[model samples]
Target chain A: MDYQRKYEKSENKNIKKISIIKYIICVIIIPTVIFIGTKLFDGKKYAFLTAVVVLLSCVPFIISFEKGKNSTEKMVILAVMIALSVFGRYCFSMIPHFKPITAITVITGIYMGGEMGFLCGALAAVLSNFIFGQGPWTPFQMLAWGMTGLIAGLLSRYLKKYMVALAAYGAVSGIIYSMIMDIWSAMWQDGVFNIKRYVACIISGIPTTATYIVSNIIFLLILARPVGRKLERVKLKADIIEKD
Target chain B: MNDKMKIFNTYHPLGLFIYFASAIVITMFMINPVMLTIAIISGIAFVLTLTDIRTFLKNLAYEIPFFILIALTNPLFSHNGVTPLFFLNGNAVTLEAVLYGLDMGIMILGVIYWCKCYSIIVDSEKFIYLFGKAIPKLSLVLSMALKFVPVFKRQYRKISDAQKCFGYYATDSYFDKIRNALRVFSCLITWSLESSIDTSVAMKAKGYGLKGRTHFHNFRFHIRDLFLIAVTLFMDIVVFTGIGTDIIDFRFYPKITQINLNAESIAVYGAFIILMFMPAFLEIKEKIKWKYYVERI
Candidate 1:
């Protein structure tokens, strides 16, 4: 029994070490390499490189989620959350650029673990875009929303304590999403990255960005309390996710 | 209903997936006039064949303003190139910028059309099959979420109706209506998350995530798929080599240089045209085969 316990302890340490390495490579190394590649490479390659780098940044979170020994209930709950966001999109379709998706994603991240939060936000992009339309911008949307959820989950403890911080984070994420998408527009326009054109795109996109910020803040303030409580209740009742 | 799908979609999912991925990516990289024209033309042709004429025209009509917006916006912001077309708000709207803007717009159009074709060809089922073997868990999550979208939407309607019956939405005040709408939303989260336990149990009972899990899918990798993939990859390599080697140059900055096509560029250009029109070639061949059989009949 002692031997088995020691073996398990070493194996757990190894797993933790591997995950840290994965994060370093995925989050830090790959992006740095892509940044260098973008500089060295000629005009249009950066467009493809950006797409690849953003997609690769998303892979670690997804791979870790898949690798974890998770329950089916978590998957089902994630499905439900994603569905709720998509339904939210339908509810507010009349309004342009204003969506409750970011707020809902953050709330889920607060309740669920970071990985499930990332999955919810990312899958919500894919699932909803399947109905709307998939474009070159889809990958960027996934990255933006996924990071929102991942960061929200990481900062859940702090955000859950203060509603103002949660709303602030939502507003910031909206800006990030809008900026990331603007990078795509600039790249698309110039076929090369031009600072002047990118700035123009940002300026043109201000109205949309403002709408995103306003909608995210409103939705976060309203939905956080009810959704977070419900998630806590649901997670607690799910048995496998119950904390001591 | 039977003819709702196109000939391109009948191939294995892997081939179709690779085709669209490479096609879309390469089209985005291309700024050469010849290549972009081929891409845009074939894209329109593919979309036309994908859907009916009226729908295609309607989509194109809707896209024109956006296309023009993308085109004209470049001159406003970008004052590149030597030849000044006009002065707009003290910014010299150069010919290069206008042309570059139009190029960007065409490139964007090609991508959008390809995406439209991709959405038509690659349904959720095919998406599940494509990723299911490689990334089972994520695919399962995607599948589950896709399935739940409609179910949740239905339940939302049901709950909203019940609330309406209770005179929840009868209030004239906008704030009250908003509050009541949120309550319905809260009620949705509760009911769905609570029932997810049973859903998960039912799935667990069916051996989900178990070892030796058999996945049922309609796609089968055939020799034709192998041929399609090989051709697609081969063309993509040629296009990449041409682009990487800086052979097919079409620059629209400072001075719009008249492109002098070398032997390599011509070869690459021919390859891209063939690459873009493969679906058209296949559809025509199918039509010819049907004609021959019908005549014999």
Candidate 2:
């Protein structure tokens, strides 16, 4: 019995040690896997698979949380967050504006944080594609957009005028998103990642990029003052609610 | 095992993984349209089985406006394809292009519906359980964001009802409705921002970004999970093979490929739908458990 107990304890310790090592490997390998996987496919299908892989690869990292949360509350929060993320993505297609995606993602990131930003960006692409149409590129769209949100969230800590930063990021990522998407398209459809095609894709996206920039600047310019002020007021109220 | 499901239910997680896998494999392998259609329909049917037929229809109803817009706009912008149907102000409208648009429209609607099924069944906690460890900051953000929605929704409802009480009639025209929507959205944004700051502060106080942050999750590897992983992996291989071999060739243009409409597609779709409704199935099972408990008393 004593021998068995010792063996079990040692095994548990070994598992813990391995898990940390696995996480470190994951951090390094994840982006590489996504880059390669995306390069292998094209369009919406490629995008969809990339997103799935990214989500799956993160599994080991998610398993390390401590237990005993308010289960119902936690579940409810998760549902709402996902819905928001999905809806955020959906609205990007439906809402007619150049900067709708960037504006929403940045604002959401500032308020919600990086993970939600990732979900929002990734899901918005996937969900919006349902309206635009799903194809081999859906996952890539998710990743491109999700990365925007994730970056915005990371930057929010440093930027006081979060909206302006968001607009700038949005404009840059808008171009980046199309460029990356085009590279994926070149790979899948042509079976070769063509620089000419990549350039052509980016050139084609100029109108959309311009629209995005204008929209982001205008949206942030208008929204930042009133919205930021109101948010400050609400924070005071939430503080009371939390204390109670 | 078949009882009212708590958050710990494995079925939903299994289904989530399946959804991810299928979405990946289907796109990667270039599965036939016939099979894709089968997968889409089966997913819907599975959702119907879990929720009421009426509820399913109602949920679909919400997507109609968006669907129409996508269908209409695609053709206006994309003037490609052969076999022009007519000339609208010297612009050609081709049969092939319209069909292409329709195909895209259907695909889009199908994906949205599938995602809805995924969201309804899995929820945030399960998603967090699956993703929280590797990306703890991201997980917390997602959890907080999810928690924030209904609070905003409830507050919006209260505010709108109050407006109605004061004779602020909300409906007049589409533009008016839009105006009201903007108002509500701005308010919601305000609320979210405030709460976000508070949440961030709270998290920081709790040592959120301290070195070596830890997570606690309770996931067990049971026979069922193994079964799911094995089955999905096998199906993925088969689906890819079907695509690679042109056994289920689905064409988008002038040429159309036929599928056998037989066992393989049907079975794959059947399993897909079941995976979607695993959450609802667990819920129903829970109700049955409560009923059995009362009966025993």
Candidate 3:
């Protein structure tokens, strides 16, 4: 019994190490590969490629790590999440008052972990651009939105209860997301990055940023508690099914 | 039927290489707008010869109005040129400005149409196969997204119809229509979300994105692809020669030169026109084959 326990602990430690390595790969290596690929390949086609790749990479993580009891039920939940992540942006963008991706990302982060949250943000950008049609700038949108999801997930851990902290992080996430996207635009469109280009991009993004801040706060206020409770209920229900 | 269309479709690396070389040549040589216009026209003509008028006309019908709107608006907003056409709200709209707008509008349409043609003729599977290993995430996203559209549209239409049958009227009233659209959108979004998740799960189970990656692709590159590359390079050389000797030009600004219409320029324009209609050409070929099969039956 003692020897078995020791082996289990070592196996667990190895698994944890692998997971950490994956986290590093996802947050750093993937982006670097995308960046270098962008520089070498034709810009427009490459942008489309990046968006697709990011979405594809998420498949394994989503499939293997899910805690759902039934495969069909698990699939149905994921589908809803993906739909909300992707088309939800378009729906909100049309409203003229709501920022779709930011709201979705924050909500998703609060519900799912940072990893799933990040995928939601990035996939939303890629899917939304289909309606806008693919272009030279789609990858920037993916990067920006993906980061928003990542930040929201990270911030959720620290700002677990305080509404003010939640709201502040949401607002900051919007600004940072836009900034990251515009950095690429400034480089590609203007062929240089400077204060002038930054100003131009930021000025255009005001309405979007405003909507994001408002939507995030609204979503946090209205949906967070209810969704959290529902999530708890879902876990309980799953537990019952598993015991059966 | 000749090499140019084949070059554009199968040998994209070669096409890209040619693009870089010509871009360098044009920039370095300071190619005149007139000469560039000639070259662009020739390229269009070549595209046209491969395809037909129907496809070009279709794109023109779709894109012209939007292009015109952009072109007209730009000159009104930007009054920086020397040659004034009229005064609008204390702004002098110049002939140069108007011409520039029109020129830009035409260029934008041309590029859009060219891209459309490229999408139509180039086998998307081939593109995915070529770059799948280099960028798996992108390839997967693009393939899935492209695949999603047709499925999405079909499902959306069916759901909308079902809703209508269930007394959900999608009316012309702005607010009501928007509401209706949102309902449909949300439902579709839900469906797509589920599909993507399932797909991801399946991919993962199949050992996708594994540390030791094994890719699956069935892309076939044939003798035609090689020929296409060679011919495209040859045509690119011809284009460069035209630009280098001041026969073709590309410029943007106050200097508007009259286009001297020559036979070679006309031929080049013809080539470009052929290139633009590759889709129509393929469709026609398909139809012809079907007819032949039917006759045999």
TM-scores, all candidates, are 0.91, 0.53, 0.55
Predicted complex 2: CAPRI docking category: incorrect
Most accurate candidate by lDDT: 1
Q: After superposition, how far is residue B25 of candidate 2 from its true place, in Å?
A: 4.5
Give one digit per residue, the lDDT tens place, for model 3 in A45-124. Answer: 23234444555455434332332122433333433454554544444555674655576667666655565566666656
Whole-model Cα lDDT of every candidate shown, in order? 0.83, 0.55, 0.55
Stretches off by above 4 angstroms in model 2 are: A1-219, A222-244, B1-15, B23-31, B59-105, B149-221, B252-254, B257-297
Q: What TM-score would candidate 3 get against the native?
A: 0.55
Task: Show the lowest summed lDDT stretch of 10 residues, model 2 chain A.
Answer: A65-74
Mind giving the per-residue lDDT tens digits that candidate 2 earns over B49-167?
A: 44667877787787777667555644554456667778887887776556655555555556655555555555556677776664555556455555555566677677667766766
| Every model's TM-score on chain B | 0.89, 0.62, 0.59
> For every model in order, what is the iRMS?
1.4, 8.1, 7.8
DockQ for every model comes to 0.72, 0.12, 0.10
